[model samples]
Structure formats: structure tokens, C-alpha cells
Target: MAGQDDERGHDERGQDDERGEGDERGQGASAPATWRRFARERVAQRRFAARQLAELRGYAGRGLVAGTVAVHLVAGLAPVAFMLGTGLALRDLGSDAAIGWLALAAGAFLVQQLVAPVQLVLSRRVQRRVDAACIERLATFSLRGASLAGLERPEVADRLSQADEAFEQWTLTPGAAVEGALALTARYTQLVGSLVVLTWAAGPWAALAGALVAIIARLGQTEAFHRWGDVIRSLAPLRRRANYVRELATGTRAAKEIRTLGLVDWLDDRYVAENRAVLDTLWTRRRAVYGAPFVAYTVAALIGSVIGLLVVARADVDVAAVSVAVQALILCGRFGVIFPESDVKLVYGRGAWQALLELEDIARRTGPEPAAAAPGARLTPQRSVRLDDVRFGYTTDRAVLDGLDLDLPVGTSTALIGVNGAGKTTLVKLLTGMYTPQSGAVRIDGEDLRTLDVDAWQAAFAITFQDYLRYELPLRENVAMAAIAHRDDDEGIRAELERVGLGSLLAELPDGLDTPLTRALPGGRDLSGGQWQRLALARALFAVRHGASVLVLDEPTAQLDARGEAEFYDTFLELTRGVTSLVISHRFSTVRRADRIVVLDGGRVTEAGTHDELVATGGQYARMFDVQARRFADEAGAGSPDEPDDPFDHSAAAGAGATGGAR
Candidate 1:
């Protein structure tokens, strides 16, 4: 069975390869310089980021970011070079060479115009690729070895939120911002060249004064941005609240209950309040970051204009030299604004980059793919499933299950019954190997479940939990999804649907098998709660009909009417006739039919016996049965009495018919 499972695993991998569904490598730098830092404490984290990014980049491909920057720089420089050439040409207006220089500059500007569109298209693709890489890694890491318990932790929730859509911003706004920085650099380059030309035309002191004003303004902006980063981080709550409001209003799961409860006013008011909070935070932070820079820019502009006039008043300067100095002054003034904004942008980019690094590090350490469990652990189980001296807790102070021991024999049907919060579901999770016991062993066959190949072992069972997924897909696909190998088998899919009493319903639909089962989509219709539950059962049964030998039906008839529930119980028993079955339910009528019944209370088994034996003992099982039986009897007696059957007569008739004689 292990070798066959491996072959199937190999085939599944080959299919994933064909479908291009696996995780792509990250695209981060790996040079020692990229990871190196003066702060020794940050070295390990930086190295992690470098490696994650490198892995991401490998899958995303290297050319997107670098190519986009290279193209943007080229596009930015073309226009600036054109303007400089034009200025120099005007300074030599009478020369033939001036016309040629102006013509070359015109051509360069046109080339820049042509390349801009192409660069935009290419950059957008890269952004999409980067976002794709982040999502792929999250899936791989989250599913690899991370337990569901870990995801339920508050710290994990925060880290997941931090990493979730944060990296997406880099692909959306930051890429363009980085491009803007490159454009700013190109403008600075043009300003420097223009000043040099003006210096040759005029005096060097004029250029010196202009450069000082630009540098001071730019440096002041950088200082202000440091304050902005702290403000934004502090404002995370308002931002998170605003996002929560949007989610509540838009999420599909929330929509049904919200509308049914008439919570439009309450939700809308909450959204409005959150929106207001977001605006308030933005206003406060923006004011703090930009207020001082606004004053600094105004003062610097006045100083720069004064410097220009002093240089212009000198008698040594010619009119042409003065004209060139004025042009240089205009360009330098523009540079003052551009350079400072770029400094602010650069600071913002670095902060976001650092946040991405931190998120990546957290994801890598706890990601789905940790080193495959210990070596030589093949995940194959030999004996029946066993939980030995197991202890577990949902929280530190509240233990849910304590020192429980049980062994489920292979190829036998066992029923578990308990009140709510009795750890019935938790026991199932342990047996199925979703959660490991805090201090004991859950073994499958004879092998420890923890050491078994989790994926392979889990693939062996067909389970129908009380809260199974009602997939918004066609009826056929919903059931077929249970048996992945039979997903495309139309006849088999339909047969499973029919077995669950959905044949008439499927045929009545507009497109028969092709009709979608969701109201959210065009031409799709929704099913009732009971109907969806039937579909969920069909999904489980389909898996059993294929190769799943271990079948778990967890409250399969929860939503059915009394008659339907009885019929379903009989059908389920027939379905799992020869397989190992573990049934969980609160209804003793349905569970009493199992080959063996186990009663759990406060996480420990209080009784284990057949229905007749348990009832004869007059224990907890008998009390529960009496409570239910009396309720059914009262309901029957209060109105129209239910038809009662004569068990002895039916048995006598069957016995006489089998003997070919009537007594």
C-alpha cells in the first residue's frame, strides 16, 4: 500500500507540474553585500530575507524588476538630455552645429515618448509575477508542516496579516515609486550638466550657491520621512479597522447572516466610524511628515531666487550668459523639489522593504514546508489506529482532553457519542492525525501518526464532518472532488449524486450536470441546507466507493427529517458494509446500530458496549436513550399516534418465508 501510494503521489506531482501549480522561487538578492550590515544583531534576519527573496526571484524570474528599472532610467534620461542639448544649442544660436544638436535632441525626446508605453506594460507583468510568487509561497509553507493550532495563535494571526497583502503593495505602488526615484536621479543629472554648462558660461560661485540650496532642501525631506515611518506604524490599528469594515461588507460568508439579521445599519455605521478613523490617522500623520518640509521648501526657494539675482547683477556676465544662468536656475529650483521628494520616497521604500523582509522571515521559519518530518519516517501505518495516554489542551489553563487511551480495530464499525465540548471532535482530529497529542501517541496501524507521511496517511480516509464544505461548483464536480482520481469520470460523479437522492434535483436544473450550484454566479442557483448536506455526504461516499477503506460519517443526517434521517442511517451502514467505520452522532437511534458504541464524557470513555447491552446496564447510554425515546413518544402521542411495528411478527413471517412454509 505504501509503494502504491508513492506511485500515486508521483503521478500527482507530474500532474501539478503540467498544471503549473507549485510554488515559484522568490526574487531577492543573495550577494554577501546584500545580507551584510553594520548592525550585527540584524545579520541573521537579513540573511534570511536575502535567501527568501532569492528563492522568490528564481520562480518569478530575474528580468522584471531590473529590466523595468533599466528601461525607466533610459526613458527618464532621454527627455533631460534633450532639454540640456536644446539649452546648449540656444547658447550657440548662429552656428550650423547648433541646428544639428537641436535635431538630435528632438529625436532623443521622441524615442523617450515611444519607450514609455512599452515600459509600462512590462512593469505591470513583473508586478503580477511578484504577487503570484508571494501567494504560492504562503500556500506551500502554510500546508507543509504548520499545524492548524499554530494558525489559531494570536501572534500567528498578526504575522499572517502582516505578510498577507503587505508584499502586494511593493508590486502595486512601490515599483512605480522606485521608478520615480530613478526619474528624480535623471533630473538631477540633467540639472548638474546644465549647471556645468552655465558655470562655463558665467562664474563658478553662482553654481556653488544653487547646489547648496538643493542639497539642504533634499536633506531636510529625508529627516521628515523618518518621522513619517514611525507615525504610519503607530496608525496600524485604524488601517486594520478600515480593512475589516471592507471585509465585513464584501465577504460572502458574512453577507448571508448579516442581511438575514438586518445588520445593515450597524455594519454601515461601523464602516463609517472606521473610515473616519482612517482619515483622521492619515490627516495627522501627513501633517506631521509634510508640515516642516513645506516651511523648509518655501524658505529655500526664496534663498535660491536671491542667489540667482546676485549672480545676474554682476557686470562681468553677458546677456547670453545671464539667459543660460536663468535656465540653470529654473532647472535647479525644480531639482530642489524633485530631489527632496525622491529622498522621502527612498525612505518609504526602505521601510516597506524592511517590513517585507520581516514578514518573509516569519513565513520561512513557520512556513508549510519545514524539513520533511524526521528522516526514515515514511508515514505508513500498519496496525489499527490507537491513542495512548494522550493529553491535550486548547489553551494553557484549560485542558480539553486528558490521558485518554483507545485502540480502534481495523475493518470494524465503532460509534462515538458525547455531549457538546466533550472532546468528541478533538478525538476525531487526533485519530485522523490533524493535531498531535501534547504528551502521548496517536498511532496508525502500529506506526506513530506523527512520524507517518502526513499527506499520504490522510489521503487514506473519506470523512464527512458536520461542517463540510458546500462548494459553489456543479453538483458533479462537488462529489467528484472527493475522489481526485475520479474527478473527470462523468458517469461515476453522477452515480454518486444519484445515490444521495440528488438525481431528480440534478435533472430538474437548467443545464442538468453543468449547472453551477451558487447564487453568486450567473445562471447559478442555491440549494437548501439539507440539500447541501446530502451533497456533502455524496462527496464522502464517492471517496469510499473508490479506494478509501476508512470512512468517517460525522453527524451525516444532522439536517434530515426524521424519516430521512432513518433512511440515511440505513444507507450509510450499507455503504460502509465491509469497511472500517467510525461514526459520531448525538442521536442514539442512529448510533445504536453500530457494531460497537463508545460513550465519551469529559474526554474519557464512560462506557463501551453494543446498544442492547448498554441499555440493559442502565448507565449513561441508557439515560440518554430514554430521554430521546420519551421525547419521540410524547411527540407521537400528543397528536396523531405513529404507526408501531410488530417486531416478532415480522421476524416470524421472514423465518416462515425462508423455510418455504407458513406455520
Candidate 2:
């Protein structure tokens, strides 16, 4: 147990090291250098705050921003105006002029009261506009990448997670930052106004002293909040884990598994433990960062207030002068103390804005750049889609596809057979240009795939992977998503659905093509697994109908039974007759019907031939086929002898053991 604790400590320290921190004890940088870094950070923070404020102003429109600013300015300066008016009123207490001064003071008070609600309403309007704009921009940035390769990177995922947490969990949105900036501006304006009033009522020396005190108190509070923000950011990983645990407990998708596995208590315990760890660390860090500073600022502020009041009391000043000086001093002290509305928003919302900027930077760096050729360049393949000695991997430690070469001839069907980890899916990704090979090339009709327009090239192929997404949308939208340009053609969509054997399912829906496919919505109904598979097939077929000549099916019928699988494969082969098709399936029964079969092993094609020819040679393909054949034979023999079943029947063995030789 001690060893485990030590290992955990080492791992945490390693993480801190990556963050460029010394250790948990905070014993790294020299004091002067640390102060310099802090100064630099403060400057950068101000610049980011300015940028966010400008963005908010743009999103909120000039009229709303101006109204909000006007409200806040009036509210901020009203106290100073009232103090001046009250002092004048006290100067001439018995005269009619004193009544006029009192009226001015009362008017200032009334104006402030009336504008307070206006400020709230305008600020909310600005926040809503900015929030909507930021969310829209985030969505756009997320989809800006042309290829899926960059999105697959771990760093991109981390940034995305941080961006999500910034918007959702922390509530430190760009909108909040803008509102905070506006409020903070008003606060500083009031502070300065109070000091100016002091200078007029007392003397310049007295006012200077008050300003120094306020600045010192504010600086300490700023440093404390900065440290607090750091602690919050460092705890993001823990918070994310807690969020995931909470989702598992509450979400419907994981409900069955959690109950069946009896993991409800375990999940609750995990969630509690993670949150407890986060709260405990937060409290510890809060005390360390805020305790001394808070005490010092309180003491300093008390001393300044007491000294200023004593000086005023000792002076031989008039009632009016004394009143104004005392009120101004109190106002200055109030402004010096930290305001949660502005300080918390500025500190945390700055971090949120920074996260968003980092996402934009990632988008710009990883998104596809313009190709040398026109982006509209069309791909009309005459020969084949080929991989030439391609070498690639998600990481440098091992290549998933190394020095591999294969070709899919146009207008011909090729079946790929391989073990589970033999790079079959990776090959399909390479062929579709979802990933680029580290060393070699993917060529279309002898032209390097990189030299062609990537978007146009990708749009030419219609692919259905093993794990197809089940969109909980209307049937028409779901099928038409593959060929959105032709979405208005409801008749064409219906025809494609009927072709994929979903005609009965379509006819059963009360809303026909408009019915949603998920039970989550009212009047919506979910389909069976086989029906969903057929819908996916229909989606791909819709793409093929609209100029997609290359059809790639990766375990497209994994959810179907033996007879259903056989029937679907036959229909698929017929529907995709003239298209270039690449079929990836574990079932040898379905693969035997392909025009050519390729056996992949050790990241390269080891055998390729007609099924009968490969069987005659007794290679890997032959061996896999024999294994399935024997499994089916055993199953046939186990049945009643009077049944007299044929083991080789495609429908009977279509759903044979998936791991027969593909283990």
C-alpha cells in the first residue's frame, strides 16, 4: 500500500513537471523571476480581457453596448455627485440655496435607482448575444478541419475537452468575461472618482495616500484570485472524471450495463471520491493562497481608514467639508475591497477565453490548407485506387500498416479478409484519405492523392463502417444525410430505402418518411438492430445514387442473422453492381462471392486470388475458409440426422463463428 501511494505521488509530480512547476511544495523559481513572470502574465491577461470586451461589443451591437455603458457610468458616478451636492447643502443650511442643493442630491439618488434595473436588463441582453455568438463560433471552428487525421490527435481532444468544460462546467463563458469587463470598468471609474473627490475636499497628499492604500489592497486580492484560478484549472482532469462518473449514473445509455453488472454503488463511490479529492485540494489551496493576503489587506485597509478619519476629525474643517471627506474615504475603501462580480469573472472568464483562443489556434494549425490545384477539381477514376508501399501508424512505436501495397480496380468488387488487428480498418481509412501515410503514397488513377483536392476526392466514396452512427432524426433526414444535395427528392430517398429492404419499416411509420428513428421523441419509434443496419445501407446507397462511385462496406451486416445477412449481401451486390466496392467482413461465406479476395497479415497483403484458385493453393485464405467450413459442418452434424442440412449453403453459414480464422 505504501508503494502504491509512492507511485501515485511520483505520477502527480510528473504531471506537475510537465506543467513546468517544481513540486507540490512550490520550490522552483527564484523570487525575482517569479515576480517578473507574474507581471508578464498580468499584462497578457489585460490584453486578453480587452480582446474579449471588444468581441462582446461586436456581438452585442453598438446600441446595446452603449446603453449598458451609459447605465453603469451613471450608477458609478452618482455617489460622488450626491456627496458633492450634500456638502453644498450643508454649507448653506438656512438659505433657499441649500434647498436647491438638497434637491440636486435627491435627484442624483433617484437617477441611480431608476438606472440600476436598466443596467441589469442591458447587461443580460449583451450576455445572451455574446453567448450565442461564442457557441456558434465554437461549432464552426470544430468543423473547420477538412481531414479527420488532426481531430484524431490526443492534443486536439484535450483542447476540445477544455473548451467544453469552460463553456459548460465553469460557467466562465466569453459572455461572462465581457460583462465582467464592463462592470470592472465602472468599478475603476468609481474608485478614481472617489479619489478625485477626496483631493478636492481634503488635499492632494491625503488623496495620494488613499490611492496608494487602495492599489496595494487591490494588488494583493488580484494575486490571490490568480492563484485560485490556477488551482481551478489544475483540477480540470479530476472534474472531468467526476462528470463522466455522474453521466454514467444518470444517462440512459449506460443504465442497463450498470444495473446488470451491479455497479451502481461502485459508481456512486467513485463519483464521491473524485469530487471529494477535488474539493479537499481546492480548500487547501484556497487557504494557502488567500489566507495571508486577506488578513494583510483587511489590516491595511483598517489602518488607512482609521488614519484618514482621525486626520479629518482633528482638522478645524466646516461641517460640509468634513461630511464630504468622510464619505469619500469610506467609498474609496469599499471600492478597494475585492468585488466578486468583477474579480471572479475577470480571472476565470479570462481562462475560458484563453481556452477558446487555443482551440482557434489548433483549428488554424491543423485544418487543411488550400491545395495547389483548385478545390473543385473532380476525381474521375478510370484505373484503380492504389496504395503504394504505404507506411503509417497512430504512433511511432509501431506501424499499423507498414510497406503495404494494394489496389481496388474500378468497376470491380474486392473482398478484404484479415484477423481482428490486421489493419483492415486502417487500410480503409488510408484509402479514403482520412489519414495520410507517413512514408509512401495513396494514388488514384496514378495521381498522388495529396495532389488532388481532398474534399472532392473524399466526397466521391460512400463508406459504411463497422460502428455506424445511428442518427436519431427523421427517416428522410437520416437517409438523405449522405446525399444532402438531393434531400428534397423524397421519392428517391424512398426508393433507396425500399432497395435496402426497409420498405416495410417505412410503410409502418405513421408519419412515413418524417418519423424520427428514436423513442426519445414523442410519436417516434426505434428500429430493430437489423432494421438500423438496413437504414445505414440505404444511407450509403443514397450517396452512391448521387455520383459516389466507390462503395466501401466494413462489416455492414454485423447485426443481422445468418439468413438476413445472406439476403442483405445478395441485395448489396446487386445494388452496387457497377460501383468499385471494397467489402470488409469476417464471414467467409459472404466473401466467397466477391470477384477477388485479398488476405491481409502482418500489415501487408500475403495472398490475393479468386476463391477457388486460393483454395487450390491452400494459403491463408484457403485455411480460413476451411476453418469456417468445418465449423458449419460440425453444426450441421449436431442437428438431427434426418434433417440432412447442407453446411455449404450461404444462408445457413452466413453468421458462422466470426473468430474462426480471424482471431
List per-prediction Cα lDDT, in the order shown: 0.65, 0.77
Across 261-360, the per-residue lDDT of candidate 2 in tens digits comes to: 9998999899899889889998898999978878887788778878777766766768888888888888767755678667887777766655566555
Weakest 10 consecutive residues of candidate 1 by summed lDDT: 654-663
Which ten contiguous residues of candidate 2 have the minimum total lDDT?
A: 1-10
**TM-scores of all predicted structures:** 0.78, 0.88
User: How many pairs of residues collide in model 2?
Assistant: 0
Instruction: Using lDDT, give the best candidate's number.
Output: 2
Candidate 1 overall lDDT versus native: 0.65
Candidate 2 yields a Cα-based lDDT of 0.77
- TM-score of model number 1: 0.78
* Candidate 1 deviant stretches above 4 angstroms: 1-60, 63-66, 158-242, 250-260, 293-381, 645-663
